[model samples]
Target: MRSVEKVGKTVNDAVTEALIELGASTEEVDIEIITKGSKGLLGFGARDAKVRVTLKAPAEVEPQIEVISEVKEDVKVANANKETETVAPPKSSKVKNKEKKDSEDAVVVTRDELAHVQALAEEFLYKLLREMNIEATVKSEVVNNNRLSIGFEGKSMGVVIGKRGETLDAIQYIVNIVANKGRTEYVKIMLDTENYRARREETLKKLAYKLSKKAQQSKKPIILEPMNPYDRRIIHSALQDSKIVKTHSEGKEPFRRVVITPNYQNKSYR
Candidate 1:
C-alpha cells in the first residue's frame, strides 16, 4: 500500500488533496485525520488540518497457462521413451468426441467474432478519446459470454465520469453501436475507467438506503434529482426489495429520475 500526508484548510480539503495524488476514489483509501485544525483569531493563528491517506494495494494475478507447453514436452518425452505400442480409441468413440467438440465450439461467442469485437471496441474507444483531446490507453478484454469490456486508464476520469457518469454512458452507447453494427449477435460492451462503475453503484446503493429512511420517516414521496437511465436503474435495483419503501422511475430519457416512497399498503389495511 502507498501512503501520503497532506495539509489543508480543513480535513476534507486535506483528504481531497491526497486522493488526487493517489488517483483514487474515496472508497479505495484509508484516511486518518492527524489534526482537525481550528481557526484562531481571524486566520492569523489558524492552523491547517493534516491528514494521512493510504491506498490499498492491487491484487496479484492468478496462475496461468504456460503449463500447457510443459505438458506437451512431457507427452513428447513419454512417447519417445515408450517401449510398448499404444492403441487408439474406437472409431465410434472418436466420432462422438468430434461431435462433442463441435458442439462446445458453438457457444454464444465464436472465436473469430470475439476477436473482431475486442479489436473494434479498443480502436473505437481510443479514437473517441483522442477526439475528445484526452490521452487514455483503452484496453479490451473478452468477458463472460460474448461480452466485451473496454477499460480506460488515464487521469481524466472525472471528466469521463462526468457529474454522474452521463458522459461515460453516452460514450458507451456510441461504442456499442459501433461494435454491434451489422453483427448477427449482439456483443454486450461495458466501458469503465478503473472500477468507476463499481464505485458508482456502491454510492447509489447507499443513497437509496438513506433516501428510503427519509421517506419512511416522513411518509412522503421523495423525488431525487434527474439522472440517466443507468443511474435510475441503479436506484431502482437498490430499493427493489426494501420493506419500508418502493422505488420507481419517472420523466423521460436524459431527464428521467427515481422516486422513493414509503410503502403504505399494509398500513392502510391495518
Candidate 2:
C-alpha cells in the first residue's frame, strides 16, 4: 500500500499547491472558504491563513495502514457514512435557503402594502392634527392584525389624547374606516400619544374599582360622564369580575357612559 501524504498551507495560496502535490484537478478537491481570516490590526497584527489537503493515488492505490486506522476511528465516533447520507450537495444553480413562499414561516408584508399604510397615515395624521392646531410628528408605527398604531412624539400630545383620550379614540375610529377603505379586512387604527392607550387603560382599571366601591356604598346607580365607546367598553371590561357591582354602558357613540350599579339582587342595597 502506498502511504498517502497530507499537506497543509495558508489558505491565501494553498489551493494550487495542494492540487499540484496531490496530482488532482481543482474540481476533485473540496475547497472550504472560511471568513474572518487573520487580519492585521492597528498595523501590528497579521493572521496566517490555513488549508488542509489530502493526497490520493492517481491509479487508486490500496489504502495505507495509517489511513485505514484513521478511517476506522472516524467511523467509530463520527458515523461518517451516516453524515454523508444525511447531507446532500446543492444541485441547482440557485443559492440554498432562498426564500420560498410555502416553506417560509415568517409573515411577509409587501413593500407596496407597507408604503401604502405609511403614506396614507402620514398624510391623514398631518392634516387632522394640523387642523386641530396640535403640532405633532408621527414616531414609531406598526401594523398589527391589519391595524395601524401611529405613535406621535411632540410637545404636549395630551391635546390629542383629550379628556380621557376621547379625541384620540374618535380620531382613530374615523381613520380606521378611511385608511382601510374598500379593503375586505378593515384595519383598526390606533393613534397613541406616547403610549397613551396603554397608560389610559391602567387608569380606567383603577377608576372602575373606585366607582364600583362608591356605587356599592351609595346603593345608587352612578351615571358617570359620557365617554367614547372604547372607553366605556374598557370600564365595563375592567369590572367584569366584581361581585359587589356590575357595569353597563348608556347612551350612544360619543355620549356613551359607563354606569356602575350595586348587585341589584342584594336586598340591602335595594
Candidate 3:
C-alpha cells in the first residue's frame, strides 16, 4: 500500500488532488486530514489545507473455472459470396418541418406566452410582498416583447431593494423561476424598483464609453469587473455602435468579465 500527501485550499480539494494523482476511487483509499486551512486576508500568508491518502490493500482471491454446457453446432456459411441489401426508410418533408418547429418552440418564447407568464408572475410577486409585510404595487411593463419586466413601487421599498440591490436580484431570481415554470420556451423576467435597472444600464453604458475611450487612446485592452449576464449584455449593447472599440465576455459565471478593446475603425464587424 502506498500513501501520498496533497495540499490545497481545503481538505476536499486536497482529497480531490490525491484521488486524481493516484487514479483511485474514493472507496479504494483512506483519507487523513492534516490541517484545515485558513482563508487569510488579501491572499497574504494563507495556510493551505493538507490531506494524506493511503491506498487500500487488495484482497486475496482464489481463481476457479465455472463450466458452461457445450452443444454440437451445425455450421452455416459466413456471408461468403453473399449479397446484402439495405432498404432506406421513406422521408417526409412535413415530418422534418414539424420536428424543426417543435425544437424552435422549445427555445423561442412568443409574445402571447410571455404575456400570460408575466401576469402569473406579477400576481405571485404581489402576494409574496404582501406576505413579507411589505405592501407593494407590482406592475408589468407593457412595452417589452417576449420578456417580462415587473416594476415594483411601494411606500417602503428600501428593504426589498437591499444592499446594492442584492435583495432585488434575489427576488427577481425567484420571480423568474415562477414565470418560466411549466413553459416550453424561455421567458426572461426582470424586476425593477425605483428604475434601478435603467439607472444600472446608464451607469454601465457610461463605464463602457469611458473604458472604450481609455482603451482606444492607450491602445490597450481593459477588463471590467465580473458582472451578471444581464449587466454584461448591457455593456455589450452600449458598445455596439462604437466604431473604435469592441467588447467580449470571458471566464465562467459569477467571475466572468467583459474585455474591451479598440477596434481602429478599419476592421469590419457585425
Candidate 4:
C-alpha cells in the first residue's frame, strides 16, 4: 500500500488518490486518522500528521484491476532481486560498484512525510505511557523496513522495560493496537529503551542456536525459561528449519518460552 504524509495542507490527499483509483466517490470509502500530528517548541518541532484509510465497494464494482496488478509486479521484482543476489557472485569490479549504487539508491524518502510519521508515533506513545501512570517521553523516527522506532526516556524507562522486557513488550503491543485501530495501512511499531530490544534479540538468537546444538548432541529436550512474547517468537523463528532439533513455544503470555527437542525421540520432559 502507498502512504502519503507530506506537509503544506491539512487534508486527505491520500483519500482522494484512493478514491480516484477506485473509481468510487469519496463516500464509498471509509477514512480514519489513526494518529495525530505534533507541534513542539515554537514551530521548530512542528510537522504534519497521517491517517490510514480503507475503501469498500461491491465485489463487481471495485477499482480497476491495475492497482492489484502493480502490487503483484512489485512482488515479482523483489523476488527476482533476491534470487539474483543469492546466485550471482561479486567477481567483477563493475558488478560490485553497481551493487553498492543500488543499495544507496534504495533509501527513498519524502522528508516531510517521514517527519509527519515520526511526530504521530511520538505523540501516541507519550499518551499511552502517560495513561499507564508512567511518566516518560516518547520519541520516534522512521527506520528501515517501513517500521517506526520508538524510544522511551525519562526516569521511569527502567520501569517501562520491566524484567527481561516482558512488560515493555506488552506496552509495545498495546501501542500497536491502539495506533492501528480502524486503519487500512499496516505500520510496524518497534519500542525500545537504549537499544535494549535489538541487543536482546541478537542474544536470543545466539542462545537458540546454542540450545539447538546441545539438544542435537544430547538427544534430549531443552526447555528454556519463561520469556516475553517477542523473545519466544524470535527463538521459534530462528530455529524454524533446524534439521537437528524442533522448536515450540509453551505457556501463556508474559511467561512463554521456546523448547528445543531433538529430531529423534529420546529423553522427554513432561
Query: What's the TM-score of every candidate structure?
Result: 0.57, 0.49, 0.53, 0.47
Question: Which candidate do you rate higher for lDDT, 1 or 4?
Answer: 1
The candidate, 3 or 4, that scores higher on TM-score is: 3
What local lDDT score does residue 71 receive in model 3, on the 0 to 100 scale? 7
Tell me the RMSD of model 2 versus the true structure.
32.4
Alpha carbon lDDT of each predicted model: 0.69, 0.56, 0.66, 0.58
Q: After superposition, how far is residue 142 of candidate 3 from its true place, in Å?
A: 4.1
Cα error, candidate 4, residue 110 (Å): 8.8
- How far residue 65's Cα lies from its native spot in candidate 4, in Å, is 58
| Candidate 1 TM-score versus the reference | 0.57
Runs of candidate 3 exceeding 4 Å displacement: 1-119, 141-146, 264-270
* lDDT score of residue 179 within candidate 1: 82
Check candidate 3 and list the clashing pairs. Answer: none
Clash counts for the predictions, in order: 0, 2, 0, 0
Error of 1 at 62 (Å): 56
Q: What overall lDDT, based on C-alpha atoms, would model 4 receive against the true structure? A: 0.58
Which regions of candidate 2 fall more than 4 Å away from where they truly are?
A: 1-115, 127-135, 143-145, 163-166, 252-255, 264-270
What CA root-mean-square deviation does each model show from the true structure?
Answer: 23.5, 32.4, 20.5, 20.5
Evaluation by lDDT, superior candidate among 2 and 4:
4
Clashes of 1: 0
TM-score of model 3 vs. true structure: 0.53
- Please report, as a residue range, the 10-residue window in candidate 1 with the lowest summed lDDT: 83-92
- Runs in model 1 deviating more than 4 A are 1-107, 266-270
